[model samples]
Target chain A: MQKGGELVERTETRLNPGYGRWTPFWFLAPAVFALLVIGIYPTISALVTSFRRYNITRPRDGFPFIGFENYINVLSDQTFWQSLGLTARFYVTVLPFQLFFGICIALLLHRPGLGMLRALARISLVVPLATTYAVVGLIGRLIFNRDFGVANQFLNAIGIGGMDWLGSPTGAFIAIAVMDIWQWTPFCALIFLAGLSMVPVEIEEAARLETSSKTALLRYVQLPYLLPGLTAMLILRSADILKLFDMVFVMTRGGPGAATDLVSIYIQRVGFRVFDMGMASAQAILLLIMTIVLSRLYIRLIYKEIE
Target chain B: MSTTLRRVLHGAGLIAVLCFTLFPFYWMVSSSFKDQSDLLASPPVWFFTPTFANYADIFADEKVFGSIVNSLIVATLTTALSVLLGAPAAYALARFEFRGKSDLWFWFISNRMISPIVLALPVYLLAVQLKMLDTYLVLVLIYLTFNLPIVVWICTDQFRSIPIELEQAARLDGADQFTIFRKIYVPLGLPGIAVSAIFSFIFSWNELLYALVLTRRSVQTAPVMATSFMSGYELPWGKIMATGTVIVLPVTIFALLVSRHMVRGLTMGATK
Candidate 1:
C-alpha cells in the first residue's frame, strides 16, 4: 500500500512538475469557459446588438448596424424615462422599509432570552426567502384583488372602503412595493440577525455599563457593529430590487397605465412584446451600466466605512 | 421601560413578526384547499371544509404537470452542473497561488453583480440563432450566470476553512494531490459543499426570469405556468393558489432542512 501510494505521488509530482503547474488552470478552465459562453459572450452580443436593428418581426430588414439610432430612440422615448423614474421610486420606497423593519425584527429576534420565540422567528423568516418571486406576485394579486380580496376585506372591516390595487396607477405601484417588502423583509432580517450574532457580547456589555438607555445602546454600539451587515444587505437588496421583474410581471404586467413599468419590465416589453430587440438591447446596456455604477458606489462607501 | 412591559412588548413583537412572515403562506395553502366561493368570501372565510378540488384541477391540467417536470429537470441539472464545474475552480483558488489570482477571483465573484436583463435579450437572440430556444439545455446553461458565482464563492470559503496542515500531512503520507483533494478535503469540506448545493438548487428552482423569457409552450416551468393564470379574464384564484403552493412547498421544506447553514451561505465573504 505504501509503495503504491508513493508511486502515485511520484508520478504526480516528480515526473510532472509541468502538470502540477497547470493543474489550477485545468480546474478553472471549465468554469471560465462556461462563463465566457453564457456571461461574457451575451454581454458582448448585447453591446453589438444594441447598435443594430434586429426586430424579430422584421427579419428581412437584415439586422443592419444602425450606429447610435437605437440608443437615441431609447433615450428619446418618454416611456423609458418614465420606467427609469418608476424604477428609482420603487427602489427608494421599498429599501428603507425593508431595512427599517428588517433591523427592527432582527433586533427583536436577537434579544438574548427568547429561546423558543427566537427559533420560531428564525423558521418563519426562511419561509419568505424560500418563496419564489412569481408566486409572491400571485399571492399579492390574490390579497389585493379589489372585489373580494382579503386586503379589501380587512380594509372594509376597519370602515375604510376597499381601494383598487392593480386597477389604478398609484395603487398598483404601491401594491408592488408592498409585495416586495413582504417577500424580502425577512431576508434582510435574517442577514441582520447574522450580523447581530457577530457583534461581540463584551462590547454590548461595555456599552450597557456606559448607558442604561436602550436607544443609546443601539445607536452607539449595535448599529456601528452591524454596519457591515447592513451594508451587505443594502447592496444585495438594492441590486435585486433594481432588476425586479418577475413579481411586477405577474402582478401587473406593467399595466394600469404603465404605473409599475420597472426598467426590466420596459426592456422585456420592448424586446419581447414589441419585438424591438435593438432598442431593448440599448436599454439593457444602460441598465447594466447603472447597476455596475451603483454597486461600485456602494462598495466605495462601505470600504470607506471599514477603513 | 419596565421589565414586564418590555417582556410583553417582545412577545407581541414576535407574534406580529410570525404573522407578517407566515400569513400569506398560510393564506396560499388554505386558499388552495378552499372552493372558489370560499376563496373570495367577504371578510375571508376563517373556517370551511378544506377541499382539494383546486389541487385536482391543476394536476388534471397536463400542461401544469409538464411544467413542473420541466422545472425539476432544469433546476436539478443546473444545480448538479454548477457544483461540478464550480467546486474545482473554488478549490484551485483556495489552494493554489498563481498570477492574476486575486483579479480572477474578483472577476468570478463580480459576475453575481451583473443584471439578468443585460443577459436576457442577447441570450434570447443567441438562442434563436442557435435554434435552442425552449430547450432545457439552454436554460441549464444560462442559469450558470447566477449559479456559478454562488457556488464558487461559497465553496471557496468552505475549502479555505480546511486547514492546510491536513493536506500537507496527506501529501507527506504519499497521497497524490488529486487523491488528497478527493479523500481529505472533499469529505472535510462536505458541509460547505452541501451549503453550496442547497443554495444553487434553491436559486435555480426559484429563478423565473430566464425560464419565463426563454421558454414558451413546450418547456415552460411551473412559475411561468402559474403566471399564465393571470392573463385571462375571471382569473382562476383556486388554481393559481394551488400552483403557488406547489412551487413553494418543496423549496420551503428544503430550506428548513438546511436552515442552519442558510445565514452562513447568504452572508458569504461579507461578514466573515
Candidate 2:
C-alpha cells in the first residue's frame, strides 16, 4: 500500500510540480465554499421561492407551493411587459450614442500628436467612471431641475431652454438616458482605447500608407482588433442596462407615470414595496435566464480567444 | 485639410470631450459649496462665493457621518475578505492545470454577470431567516457575490503573468506551494492585487441595490444615505450634493491613483 501511494504521488508530481494531488484542491476550497454560500445558495433559494406563493404581507398563508402560478402571473402582467419594453428602449437609447461618441473620443485620444491634452482627457474620463451610480442619479436630478438645472441653462444658452426634464414622461426618459450616457461613455471610450491599442503599430502604419483615408484604415485594420473588446463591452454594458436600478431608483423612482420604469425597478417595487416575493422571484428568474444565455455566449467567446 | 488644421480640430475635440466628462463633477462639487440662493439660481451660478454651510449641515447630521463610517468598514472588510479568499484560488488556477478548472473559472466570472436584482430578493430572505438583516456581516457577504469574482478574475490573470520558472526555482529551494505563493507570487503579483483591491473597494463603496435592501439603519452605506435625502417633501439640492461629493471623493481619488490600470480593471482583464 505504501509503495502504491508513493507511486501515485510521483505521477502527480510529474503532472504538476512539487505539489501533492490535493494541493490545488486545498487552495481552491475556501473560494469555492465562499462562492457556494455567497453566490450559488441565494440563486438556488430564489429558484425555489419563485415557484411558491410567498408574499410577506400574507404571513398566515405560509408560502404554500403553487408551482407555475407565479411565473404565469408575471408573464401575463401588463406592467411586467411594459417594464420589459421600457428596459429594452432604455438600452437602445443609450447604447448607440455611447458607442458613437465613445469611439469618436477614443479615436481622438489615440491620435499621436495630442500629447499632454490626451493624458488629461484620459484622466477626466476616469472621473465619470469613478462616480457612484446613486450619486450620478442625484447629479441627474440637479442637472435636469427645470428651474435651476445647468442643462436648462445650457439649453437657454443655445436657444432651447425651460425644458421640464424630469417632470414629463418623455423628458424623464431622455433625462435618464442622458445621465446614463454621460456616466458610461467614458467607460466605453476606455475599452475602445484599449482595443485600439491592441492594433499592431506596423499594421496601422502600413494601412495608413495604403489608404490615406482615416475611414479606410479604421475599417480595414482597426475594426477586427476592436471586435473582441467591443463584444466584451457589449456583453457587460447590456447586462448592466438590464439590471439598471440605482440611478433610476434615486432619480425618478420609475416615476412620471412609469415612463422610465425599467424592469429591475418594477421588480423591486413588487418585491419590496408590495411585498410580493413569489411574483418578484419569478420575474427575477426570467431575468436570470436571459443573463445566463448572454453570459454563456460571452464565456464561449472568451474561451475561444484564450485557446 | 492642412495638417495644422487637423491637429487644431483634434485638440478641440479632446477639449470638448474633457468638458463633457468633467462638467458634472464640477457641478456636483461646486453646487455642494453653494448656498441655497446660488444653488437655486435660474441661470445656475457658474461662479460664486463658496460656502461651507451645506457641508456643515450634512456633517451635523449624524446619519451622514455614521453611514460614511459604515461604508468604510463594509468596503474595507469586503476587500480584505475577497483578497484573502480569492488570491490563493487564483494562484492555484494559474499554476496548476487541473480538471474542472475551466468550469470553476466560468462559474466565478459569471457571478459578476448575474444581476443583483435577481439575488437581492433571495438574499434578503436568507438574511431575514438567519436574523442577519441590518448587519455589516450580511452586507459583506452579499457583496462577496460580485467582489469575490472580481478578485478571482483579475488576480488569476496577474498570477499567470509571473514567470513559471520562478515557481520552479522556489520549489528547488525547498519551498512548498504555499511558501512559493507567499514569497514569490504575492510579491510579483502586488500590482494586480492592488488593482483588484481598488476595484473591489470602489465597487463595494458604490454598491446600492444590495446595500439598500440588505441593511436598513444600522449599516446603511454612503450611497444609501445620499439617496435617503430624496424622501423628503422638498429636495435639498445643496445638502444632497454635499453628500454626493463626499461619497464620490474617495473613489475618484482611487480611480486616478490607478488610472493606468483602468482599462484592465474595467474589462476584468479581457483587454489586458
Best by lDDT: 2
| Per-residue C-alpha lDDT of model 1 across residues B149-206, encoded as one tens digit per residue | 8899888888998977577667668887678778987899888887788888898888
What TM-score does prediction 2 earn?
A: 0.96
lDDT of each: 0.85, 0.90
In model 2, the Cα lDDT at residue B270 comes to 70
Per-residue lDDT for B62-136 in model 2, tens only? Answer: 999999999999999999999999999999989887788888888888887888999999999999999999999
lDDT of 1 at A158: 93
lDDT of 2: 0.90
Question: Considering every candidate listed, which one attains the maximal TM-score?
Answer: 2
lDDT of 1 at A28: 92
Q: Where does candidate 1 chain B have its weakest 10-residue lDDT segment?
A: B263-272
- lDDT for model 1, please: 0.85
